[model samples]
Target: MSRIGKKPVSLPSGVTASVDGQTVRAKGPKGELTYVVNDEVLVQLGDDGIKVDPRDTSKDARAKWGMSRTMISNILTGVKDGFEKRLEITGVGYRASMQGSKLQLALGFSHDVLYDVPEGIQISVPKPTEIVIVGIDKQRVGQVAAEIREYRGPEPYKGKGVRYAGEKIVRKEGKKK
Candidate 1:
């Protein structure tokens, strides 16, 4: 049995969840989100909370049981409080700013990198070196942060680039004299 799947996901205050066939939709103060459960799992909304059970006692069904439960929980929490990711730029002349609805990044390139902001996601640059990505969907927030970090990953030698706020870079030894 899946430990996580055994536990139902409870709806917090002001958050509502509905079940429609294999899809589960959640709405809260922040926003609304939906999740389509896998066929190997059974999803239902009960008095306690949202429950996910395996359709059969098979390896694939068990695997999807926990995953489906977690996905439903993520959508519930996401709609309730939202999600955010922070990135820090570490390099000379490397900075970020907001241009209209786009993100302007200057990472020692010949020209500034302009990233068009997508719908339902907000990118904020409080400081030139700090970038905050926020959205109602947890997956989208993380994906956007990863894409931004991909632009200039931190180097091992100088560790100069964009990285997660608390990420640690493994340094490499310099050239021998």
Candidate 2:
């Protein structure tokens, strides 16, 4: 038995969970999220919490059971508290700012890089070097942060670029003269 899959997902006060055929939908204060339940997985909504079960003892069914449980858990958590990703710009003149629905980044490029923020995602620049991304969907928040970080990955030398907050970059030694 999978420990994670066997655990029941506690439902919050304001969150509503519904299972329709192969799709499970969760709605709460933050937002609503839907996930497709795997074929080998079965979901049971109890009075106290939600439970997930595997249809068979096969390997594939066991894997699907875990995955389905995780997906449902994420949806429940996402609609309640949402998700966030923070990025920090490190460099002499590297900075980021928000203009309307776009994020303007100055990452040592000749021209400023403008990244359009998608709907359902919120971008905030608390400081010139700090950026915060917030959204109800975990996948979308992570994707946006990854795309921004990809523009200028952290360098091993000066460590100048975009990276997650508190992330460390190991500096490599330069060639001897």
Which segments of model 1 are wrong by more than 4 Å? none
Q: Estimate each model's TM-score.
A: 0.98, 0.96
Best by TM-score: 1
Q: Whose lDDT is greatest here?
A: 1
The ten-residue window of minimal lDDT in model 2 covers: 41-50
Give the alpha-carbon lDDT of every model. Answer: 0.94, 0.92
Write the residue-wise lDDT of candidate 2 on 1-177 in tens digits.
899998988888899998787788899999889998888888888886888899889999998887788888888999999999999999999999998889999999899999999999999999999999999998999999999999999999888899999898999988899
Show the colliding residue pairs in model 1. none
Candidate 1 Cα deviation (angstroms), residue 94: 0.3
